[model samples]
Target: MDFELPEEYAAITDTVRRIVEAEIKPVIGAYETSGEFPYPVIRKMGDAGLFGATFPESLGGTDAGFFAITAISEEFSRLTPEFGYAMNQQAMTCPFTIFNWGSDAQIERFVPDLIAGRAIGMFALTEPGGGSDAAGAMKTTARRHGDIYRLNGSKQWITFANACDTGLLFAKTDPAAGHAGITAFVVEPKRGRGYRAHPIAMSGLSNCLRSCAVFLEDFEVPVENRLGAEGEGFKIAMNALEYGRLTVAARLTGLAQACLEHSVTYSKERLIRGKPLGEYQMIQQLIADMAVNIPAARALTWRAAWTMETGRPSSRAAAQAKYFAGNAARHAAQAMADIYAGYALADEYPVKKIAAYVNMLTVGEGTPNVQRILLAEDALGIKDTDRHPVRNRARGHLSR
Candidate 1:
């Protein structure tokens, strides 16, 4: 029943907070204005061991565990949501997946650079067709040759695609086999042939982070780069997402807290009718909603993190956390906009950016509708989320 985070985890949080203030806060605006990635800040974070929280010391990580990574995500996003995504992209999905399901040689080759932020990593799962039904509707295919697999397909909404030195790319090896046909490959775009990335301009996180449409035409990946056996891609992707959703929820919680803090500050300073805006009941109500929602979202996220850390079935908890946290972030964004009124739209103020970030969060990880459907199926005895092979495997590995 202990709710407090361990002292070591708290120390990690404190270090990240300092890094954000010293390295990010000072230069983030310039990067946003220029629409550029903050490589220096990222390197600083890497130097501070921010990206290595979940890995063992042998792999250049502290093995701080899932809860520590979740807390670190929250601290990163609290001030800047764009940087928070780096935690997930670089540490959570791509590297962790490779660590979990990859061969010893593969882990030795990629994990250290990724966790050190010496290399950027991307997770290429969602296709142009659709993300919610990624495995079912996947258009990507990986055909085996001699020592290499020739891959061809276009991936949509791929974060860090434009800059990733390496990534986990999924494609169907046996297209007729449906979900079971999918296979995972570690594609090195920097050294590999036939990999093209076109950045997609978006309203949110446009400046600091780049989401792209990635086209793989006759791309050659070595046979040794394959993760697990053929047809295990879907399972690996889902397992990674079980971890990904927690980070997503943590980011939303941080965003909600930021909105609440900003609203409270504005309420005290904004004068209307010869009194501060905080004096108004309507303003109080909006702030109150944010105040309430933020903690609830955070609590759910922590619960999910604990579940994953303890090697328990976490799909239900992750979904619940992500669903509630996304809604909370959306609500907080709206409240911030309402409180700011005309100022919310101005670039000088962060409200507009926060709102746009919230909009993206709604669809990331899993959409609200998608999460609802999963939960519904679970509740109706149609699916036993706790009884998956992935969860069982995770239990054995994570428990250690």
Candidate 2:
């Protein structure tokens, strides 16, 4: 497959690069230090039309493909991985699912706001009691009553839960149908709506807002708010996640790139024993390995994006890409930290921030062990011990 980006895609990527350089990188550390979510910067991203790259122009997007989206993700992440998180939450997880499964009316009502960045969206699938076994452990129920669905259940680890305008909420509609019983709804936390969201504090992922545990008790959703139809939520969730996994891969690739660049610059400039660190064979090896892995991860990410664009099943490729890219990022971060020594532990060094970002990415879209299991099933055709196996534990709604 041709890996070279077309001129048009390059232009879009270049625009994203310029935006990151001019806007995001300068203030990322301040935002992280203050424990803020960078709302104004995200609004600027909306003005730049970064939120709708993959959607059609009819939906206020640029009519871009997933490749362009990948490029945007990589560049933004290279500068500030937290911004990458926000971008993915917007470009991939939130709006993509809505456009695909939402009713036409729902699309009309939400898509424009999303593309315009007037409102942010989030996906709510994971729960407190259920981890990866969401289908079996789903305690959230949507009871059919009169003309509305009464949603009762709590979703845990919901990203942007406190800041999002709409969420793709999953609930079990038919308790007896197992996975087939699940249904998805468009839940809006507004004055007239029946929804409430509370923030969950977290120390591990302080760069962005940690996912929240939202309790939906007697949450009333209009019958029209149901996405697609009943019993179709699982498929919708999976499809959205399949694409979402690729974004995670792309974002990790960017973070790895940052680590490598920072490490290389430090090695070249810092003198060790009357010689620059770059002259040492061991440091050279680390840098070489990083160079080798970054592009390799990038290729895998591009292939996964291409798979989606070409109407192919990307589940296996997505799993592989996310797994490999995450490992590569972690190693890069560790290697950079070692090279930087004490400086790596401080936030001023960017390597420490890179380390945290890598830690989050390794488990964000999917965990490495979970991806291996997915690859095993895809390659060997061996069914997992759990028949309802999920690809990534991070996105699968709980820890496996």
Candidate 3:
């Protein structure tokens, strides 16, 4: 398999890098301190035609496909991993879910705003009962009431809940049906309706995005708003994660690259024991290990993306990439910190922030334990009925 990215894909990401350096990074520190999501910075991202790089031109995107999304994600994340979260939410999750499974009207109503960046989008599958047991533990309910479904229960740790223009939500439509009864819906929060969102003051990632606690008090969703058929929310949510894990893997690839860059630059400049730190064997080992880990994780992530691009089954691939890359990025963060020594604690340097970024990535897509369990399931030859929707999506890409 050819791992080299096409030239155009490289150009798109390089453009993203330039915009991030010139417009976004200058104020990242300020956002970190204030716990604010900069609307203007995101608007700039929209104006630059980034919000929909993966979407088709008919939907106001570059039609760059999954690779473009991965490219954009990696470059932004190299600076700070938070923007990657926003990208995944906007371009990868909600949009991917809608474009693939939503009704024609649903796509027309929701996707254009998201693609334009005039409206931020969010995906909520995690409930108060969220985590490894997300599907079985989900308690949110959507009761059919003739023309509309009434949504009750709450979702926590949802990115951009308070700030999003549209929300792709999952709820149990039939408790007796278990996972089968769950259904997906698209709601317009920016237009104002049944749901309420409150900001969550998180320990990390406060600067790049905000997590929100969303409460649905009889939020009315029209039957037309239903995503996919009734009882398919579980499948939709699971499929969304396949793509999400790919982005997380790529983002971690960028974080590992950041770790590599920081260490290399610091080693050349810092003097220790009457010599440059780069000359030390121990420092050299750290750099070598980081360099190794980065390309290793990046290769896995790119392979996962390519697998998706090729329209092949990729659940196991996504899980493996996310699991390995997350650990690699975390270890790289530590190595970078060790190299920085006392300076690691200082905000003036990026290593401390790198530490915080990896903490979030390690758990964002799904924890390492979850990925391991999935890989074991695949190895044990368990029939993965849950993988069909995602697999079908990947396969359908070839037809497109």
Candidate 4:
């Protein structure tokens, strides 16, 4: 229950703050408008080893803890949500997942390349057919054919798809095994045999190349690329998400903090009814509530990170942290809009951009509502600890 970040972690946060202020704040709007992936920015992060902060030094990292990683996320996100997310995906999410699940050969081949920012990696689980019900709605299949597995399916909303050279792809390997049939693979599009990745057009989170829908049609993959074991894809994917959810929670906290700060600052300077808006009772109330929420969100996120670092299973805590922080960010954005009135709607005003960033973060990674279900399941001690498994499908078949 300690709320204090360690001195070393605090130092890390300070370092991250300087990096974000210098590199991201100046051109955030332009990046958002262009909707281009920030490759140069990513290269800077890679050079700083920001992408591999928590990874083992043996694999080219500083070997910081998960909490330290979240601490950095919070600081960076406050400046620019896209910048924070892109860096995390590069530094922590994609690399950590691969390092944790990828084979030694896969690790040797991919981790260094990814960390160097020479290549990029993405994790895809969302699909067009099923957004929340990822497992049952996953229509992608990877069938075994001797030494090679031929994959045929499509994944939508795949983050970093445009720039990522490699992906941790989830597909059904044993249609007969249902969720158990799901398998994780270290899939590269160029080595793709028959895969096609097309850019998906989306607005709002324009800094991100809207999650691309990757199509695999008889894409041949070596058996060695199979992550973990057959029937283990679902588990590996869930574990990766458990870690990723915390990172998202941290980012949401940062975005919410930014919204609150913006609103507070504007309220202090803008006069209304012959006095500063901060002098108005209603405006003060909004600002006060916002102030209260940011720390609560940070505390929850850090708790979850601490739990994970301590080797405890923390799905409930993770879900609660993500759900609360995401909602907080969205509410803070709206509050900022209310405080600024017409100005909040203007693209030039930061709150307008803040609203878009918060909205996307709320739904991405995992939606807030799904997190609620996860929290309930964990609290009630549901039959399955794993909440993401396809509920309607039988164990043996992919079909519902």
Candidate 5:
């Protein structure tokens, strides 16, 4: 297989790098310090079409494909993981899921604004009770009344839930049906009533990008807002997460690279015993580990993206990539910490923040343990993670 990215993909990466350098880097620190969302920078990213890579041209996207999205994720994450996270919320999971499952009218109503960055969106599936078994453990319920569905439940760890204009919310319509009973709905927190979101303070990436606990108390969504059929929410949520995992892997890959770059630079310049730190054997070993792992993480991420792009089964690929990349990022961050020693914790250096960012990656999309379980299940032939109806549908939609 050809490992080289197309020239167009390289250009896209350059564009994202330039955008980060010019717009995000300058104000990111202040925004992070104050814990405020960077609306202006997000607007710039929207204007540059950063959120449109995986979408079709008809819907304000460049149809740049999954690889382009992967490239963009890495570049945005190289400087700060928040923008990379934002890109996933705005473009990959929320809008893409709606585009795939929503009616044409729904797509027309929601996709453009999200892709243009004029509006923000979120995917709410994880609940406070449990995230790994979100479907089976979901306590949220939806009751149908005429043309409306009254939703009553709480969703935890919903990224941008407080600021989102619109989002996809999942609730159990048939609690007895278990996973099959879950259903997806298009929620308009801003326009609709009875939706309340409270921000959950986080130590890492909390300043600009934040998550929230969302409460839906008698929140009403129109029947038209329902995605797919009843009991299809489980499939939709899982499918969306496959895409989310790919982006998460890409972000971790970028974070690992950042750690490596910083560690290498510090090792070469800092002198110990009148010799550069790079000359020391221990430092060299650490740098060598990073140098080897970053590319491996990146390659795995690209392979996952390629599988999705080619309309092939990708759940296994995504899990493997995310699992490996998360480990690589953690290793790189620890290595950077070891290399920088006390300086790693200083506010002046970005190393501390980068290391903290890696913490979020380990648990965000799916925890490393969850990935391990999936891999183990696949190995034992207990389940075929790669094959799914959603994968087929995504392939067709993306190929279009």
Candidate 6:
């Protein structure tokens, strides 16, 4: 129940907040308008040891711990939601999956470059048919060949799809195997070489993530590039998601904080009648609700993070965190908009822009409705604690 973060973590969060204010906050709008990726911002974070913040030092990291990474994500998201999300995915994306399940050669090949920002990476899971039903609706397949696998599939709404050089790709090897038949691969995506991408006309996170539909048309992949055993793709993917869901929670929490801060500032300066908006009971109520939700969501997210760090199962915890944070961000966005009235629609203010980011949070990674079903299962005691097998396996890898 101790709410205090360690001194080092606090200091790092402070620095990250300043960086977002000075760098991302000032220029993110331009990037959004130009539809360009923020290579310089990613490089700055890499230089600040953020890319390697929580990874092992042996892997060219600073061993900053996962909680610290989440803290930095939270601070940056307040200023620019896309920036916060991009930062987390930049450090995580495919590299985290490689560290967990890739063969030694694969890890040796991708880890250093990804962490150093010399190479880029991302995750490919969602498809055009469905996202919530990821396993059930996945149509991508990797057919076995003598020395390589021929991959064919279309992955839509893939974050950093066009920007990254490599990513963790999932495709079914055996349709009858159902979820068990899925396999994971680290594929190098190059145009016309079995890999092509078309930018998705997304409403939010346009500049932050640069999402697209990646088409793997008979792409050749070396068998050695497989992340895990033939049927282990689902296991590995779920495990990565357990942690990724927490990261998403962390991002949503940051957006909520932004909403609260923006609302509070507006309340003080915005005079209504003879008094400031802060003096009004209805405005006060909105602010109060927003203020309360931010910490609640944060506490849930950190608890899940701490549990995983302890090598404990986190499927349930991650779900709870994601659900709470998503709901909080959504409500807080609307509440901030309510406070701003017409100003909410202005680009100079955040409510209009951040509301879109809220959509990204609630829908990406896992949907809010999906999270609710999980929580209900947990409450009903129908969920198995052993479902998330990847957490322990990942811990074993990190320990080694």
Error of 2 at 378 (Å): 1.0
Tens-digit lDDT string for candidate 3 (351-396): 8767787888888778888888888887887856235634333236
Listed in order, each prediction's TM-score against the native is: 0.95, 0.90, 0.93, 0.90, 0.96, 0.94
The predictions' CA RMSDs to the true structure, in order, are 2.2, 4.9, 2.6, 5.2, 2.1, 2.3
Deviation in Å, model 3, residue 330 alpha carbon: 0.9
Decreasing lDDT order of the candidates: 5, 1, 3, 6, 2, 4
lDDT of 4 by residue, 267-336 (tens): 9899877899989898888888888888899999999887667655656677788899998898898889
lDDT of 5 by residue, 1-400 (tens): 4366789999998899899889987888798888777777777898898998877888888888899989999888987677887977788889988988887899999999998888888999999988988887799999999999999989998998988887999999999999999999988889889999888877645566888999989999999999989899998888888888999999999999999999989998999999999999999999999999988999999999998888777899999999999999999999999999999888788787898789887898789999999999999999888757544334574321
Scored by Cα lDDT, where does model 3 land? 0.80
lDDT of each: 0.86, 0.78, 0.80, 0.77, 0.87, 0.79
Worst 10 residues of 1 by lDDT: 391-400
Off by over 4 Å in 4: 1-4, 25-36, 207-209, 383-400
Model 6, 63-102: lDDT tens per residue? Answer: 7767876777777677667766665456765677787777
- What RMSD does model 5 have? 2.1
lDDT tens digits, residues 1-400, model 2? 5357789878877888777878877887688788666777777888898878777787888767778888888887887666777765678777877776666788788877776677777888888875566677788999999888998878887888777777788899998998899998887766335566676765445545556778787989888889878998888787677778888898899999999999989998999899989999988888989999998999999998887676555777788889889989988998998899888877567876678778877876657777887788867868532343333211222111
Please state the error at residue 255 of candidate 5 in Å.
0.3
Candidate 1 all-Cα RMSD: 2.2
Off by over 4 Å in 3: 1-4, 26-36, 384-400
lDDT by residue (278-393, candidate 1, tens digit) is 99999999988988898899999999998888877888999999999999999999999999999998878889878877778778887999999888889999987665644422
